[model samples]
Target: MASRCIVLLVAVLLSSLLVVSSSASSSPCTFPAIFNFGDSNSDTGGMAAAFATVSEPNGETFFGEPAGRYCDGRLVIDFIAQTVGLPFLSAYLDSVGTNFSHGANFATAGSTIRRQNTTFFQTGYSPFSLDAQSWQFAQFKSRSQLAYKKGVSYKDQLPPEEYFSQALYTFDIGQNDLTSGYVSNMTTEEVKQTIPDILNKFTDVIKSVYGLGGRYFWIHNTGPFGCLPYVLDRYPLRAPEVDSVGCGAPFNEVAQLFNAELNETVAQLREAFPRAVFTYVDVYTVKYSLISHAEKNGKTHQC
Candidate 1:
């Protein structure tokens, strides 16, 4: 549950925004500041320990130890940052001052859009929820402005004004609401009904950043939840016919439907703000590619 995800988006070369096949890759994204929003796939340290439970094996492999990321190696966000020559950022909760120099990761593990509210309970630390993350962005903007007034330079020496001007955002989420093992009681229809509200929450989150001057973003359509280990644990020996990729039918159908509605919603957002770039990454296809061909990623193919 702690493997929260995050994504990094930058000025998409509109010409290159088209989704490509596995043979080729996307062009280098150009962006200044990066803000991530999502569940375990992109969360850096937020899943590591912002809450009371243990943050285990979240950032292993490439980092060698916990850097708070949920996956084994650098996620897409890290790859994009590296592509643009930026240092790996720190989670917002890290007291380390260097995290402020580049970008800050606001993703929280086991969190959702409009799900958790920021609060302090004596039992454990409550990480920033989507609403809380937006508010924190406001504070970040103010502090950055102050830094500008004093002439403190960013890591690349870009002015705070330019920092945000070149900023980009990414979001890879929405699976947790339906797939968390604890929520097995929820029917597929119940999950589908929640899509509209999820999109609404996402709109609110995006607008909050827009208010803070974010003009470019990449939102991922939901992934095939039926392929995850937890899902397979529930329904092994699944029909390969229901899933061309052998994941499953029920979960993929929900993800596909959610992605369809999300695309329409993104089109609406694009229409409203023509100047802003809103791109949707194909989490569905990407995961399919990875799962169907795990050898490409050097992992054991499994249920």
Candidate 2:
């Protein structure tokens, strides 16, 4: 009789827990759109479009054709959408393929969180730069308007809110700001002074995306510069460290400071925008792991 009572009690507790879990699973931020804003790492095509260069050799391995992305193909933003049952984001230049009813990508090849990167990347524009992906995002609304006028709407039937809810906004920039601008030229002390300013600007960008009805937001820290080809070429002496997965102290030190500031900034943003769902993907960690495990994946370290 005592055993029966215990089993009955356990069953009741399980039932109660199920109710709680179900209620918590329903988040208001579960929307339908996904906006991606970042550099080559997350850019699906912003760079390719700007450079007028389609898929590169490395990119051909994954995405096939040239979708303007910088990776082997598909990036974090692509998987994020797929995780939520959304289709791959359409490229900014892909007029016929774009489906803004959900979300769009605004990541250029050399984009950064700072205006300096914005003004420095594009050879023709120099200041016209690859980092102005966010500016392209501003054009989405107008582009949508014209899409309808041109009779090329992807989802003319759905309500805006329903469409927006399905969206996810992401910003994966700053790599160039750190990698291109400061990493090569400036000393540690000079870079330290600018870290706070960099963090603050990134925080503001996250909030801006949220204000645009972007409930789902993600911020990327930075990709490893030590692993890039340029770094390998510049510091051949550090090849030993690279092979050991022990990054050169100087480059790694800069990365650490940047990541620390990034973490603190992310924490502050979370508190400021309690209603917004913010996630930070640690690209540094990913890069490090990929470097350490390159051989396991049957690949050799390039940079």
Candidate 3:
């Protein structure tokens, strides 16, 4: 899942954020910093900072220690930073050894676009919803500037005032909103009914960030979570409900519907904010294709 997501996001981001011109120029765009807001997909260490340290095996393959990421190595956001010649973003919630000179990440594992009613202990969802993240960014912006003025020692730890406008604001979220509906025992149709409100909340955050001098936006539509083991194991599906790739078809269908509406939402946002550059990347298709082509390991057994 991690590798496939990396491939899709990196490919799309490279074309949109890295490509210089149509005439084969290799120069990447000069994005001074990256202000990211999303879930575990792009979370560097927000979850660990807010809750507890992410233990071994999570970052052993990359940093040789738990680096706050849920994956074994780098995330799509990490690649985005490297591609743009910026350092990995520090989590806003982490106070240990952080550098916000480049940018700060507001994402957390188990985060949802819309605020969840349940607690983290109850539903495994982060309370730092998209709205909360936007608020954090706002606070970070104001506080960092004040801190940056203190002395020369603070200059390298905080971003320049202009970096907020020059930075790339990336988003990869909303999948948990769909699953949260399911986890709460809502029907597929009922879950589908909530997408508009969820996206409205998403739009509100984007608008909020834009109002705060963010000009560039990179949004990723949710992927096919039905194909994941968590869903398949937790929610039993009949043989007829399963697709050729063994994913829950009903859930994938809902995801598709959500993506379709999300695409329209981005278009509407583009129209609503003319000056803000919005690049919506479709990760659902890439994820589903990769799942379909994936092979089973030797340990597989049929029920």
* Models, CA RMSD each: 5.6, 11.5, 4.0
Instruction: Compute the lDDT for candidate 1.
Output: 0.62
**TM-scores for candidates 1 onward, in order:** 0.78, 0.75, 0.90
Order the numbered candidates by TM-score, best leading. 3, 1, 2
Best by lDDT: 3
lDDT of 1 by residue, 3-85 (tens): 22222221122113433311143554556667777666666666555654334464455667656665555666666566566
Cα displacement (angstroms), candidate 1, residue 288, comes to 0.8
* Candidate-wise lDDT, in order: 0.62, 0.56, 0.82
Write down the lDDT that model 3 would get: 0.82
Give per-residue CA lDDT, model 3, range 1-303, as digits (tens): 111243433454445543442125354477889999989988899999998788877876668888998876778788778877888999999998998889999999989988888899888899999999999999999888887777667678888999999888999998899998999999999999999999999989988999999998888888888887888989999999998889899999999999999999999998999987788787787666656765632221110
Worst 10-residue stretch by lDDT in candidate 1? 6-15
| Weakest ten-residue segment in model 2 by summed lDDT | 1-10
lDDT of 2 by residue, 1-303 (tens): 000001112223323432343355566334466777766656566556655675355356555656665554456566556655577776665555555666776666665566663333332221322335555665565566556566764646222544544465666666566655443467656766677877777766666555655665666666566555555555554445554675555566677788878878888877988876566656676566666676664543121
